[model samples]
Target chain A: MTIDKKLNGTSLVIALEGRLDTMTSPQLEEELKTSLEGITDLTFDFEKLEYISSAGLRVLLYAQKVMNKQGSMKVIHASEPVLDVFDVTGFVDILTIE
Target chain B: MMTLTVKAHISNLSMVQDALGEWLDSIGCPMKTSLQLQMAVEELFVNVASYAYGEEEGDLTLSYEYEEELSLVRITFRDQGMPFNPAECLEQEEESTRLHVEDRGVGGLGILMVYKTADQVHYSYRDGWNILILEKKL
Candidate 1:
């Protein structure tokens, strides 16, 4: 997966492209860990993201836990199929989607 | 019925998906059903690759039979690794009510997705192999 980042003040927006499954989730975890410092708001753009597995959900859950203490987080532009997964996994209730 | 066998590893996930996609397309499976099938397959394949044999390398065979009469598809996964039953996890989650967000974990969600997406899921240990079968209606 390719992650493109845009830093606007204290808010950080990261857009992901490609599949976010077991093979690629670790890359996202590392990116979030290193880039989250001094950031209050985190937004994920999933318009280009085609797939996500449980491994990816784990990373997003961990990120949400961290962001809860810092500020806020939102996931936007999730495709119908990806959103279906979130809905089935009950992540739709836990995460803010816009 | 058709079958495909491959080494259990995270790196081979793409190949597995590609092959399954082609087979499903050839069968003229609906796009929605195909998506669910792919999701269920990925979850089981990743589970076996990550934990079934640990450091040891093994192969997993996936076989499926599509019954046009019933409009149902049955996919079976076989591996010669540890005997781990996924159905028990589903039972435990169902009995445990009032699970809070703090209790929401990512570990069991994959198996849960497999159970939810598939119409039926069964696990058995037979002839030194762990066999998991998932059935979905088209």
Candidate 2:
């Protein structure tokens, strides 16, 4: 998957494209590591994200945990397949989605 | 005999997800089937890492073999972290207040998804490992 990052004041928006499987999860994690600092609000645009693996969910969970400390996090426009993955994993309750 | 093994750190989950799909694709499984298999892998691995290992570190071995006649991908997950098989546990239904959200969806969904996706699944604790085997016809 490809990830692009944008900053809106303290809010950080990340747009994801392609698939988030085991191989591409690291790129996302790296992006989060490099970009999350100094950003208090985070929004993930998953409209272009086609597929999600449990590993991807785990990363999301981790990002949520991090955001809990510094700022707020949200996921927007998740694709059907990726949404299904989150639904099955009970992330709907844990995450803030729009 | 063929074997592929990789040592993974539990803290990096997203990378593992990407690796799973690429692995299936490399084995010549169609994209659709690969997606299903990868989903199952994701659920099981995350469950193990989260529930079984907790905050500890352990080894995870993912092995697969293709049975051309059956057109199948037989994959197994072996880990020494804990003795638990999520498939054997019954799922908790969603509950609602008037009938609430809890009764709609709660626990056991992941294992159920794994069951639905795999053509065959089995679980056993043998040789100091929690082993889960799943087969998907390609």
TM-scores of the models, in the order given: 0.90, 0.60
Candidate 2 lDDT tens digits, B47-90:
77667776777778878788888888888888887798665563
For A30-53, candidate 2 gives per-residue lDDT tens digits of 888888888899999998887877
Chain A TM-score of prediction number 1: 0.98
lDDT of 1 at A34: 96
B4-80 in candidate 1: lDDT tens per residue? 89999989998888888888888889877787788889999999999999999999999978898998899999999
| Number of the predicted model whose lDDT against the real structure is largest | 1
The CAPRI category of model 2 is incorrect
Please tell me what DockQ candidate 2 reaches. 0.18
Task: Note the chain A TM-score of all models in turn.
Answer: 0.98, 0.95
Count of backbone collisions in candidate 1: 0
Query: Per-residue lDDT tens digits of candidate 1, residues A1-98?
Result: 99999999999999999888877899999999999988899999999998887788889988888898899999999998789888877788779999
lDDT of 1: 0.87
Best by TM-score: 1
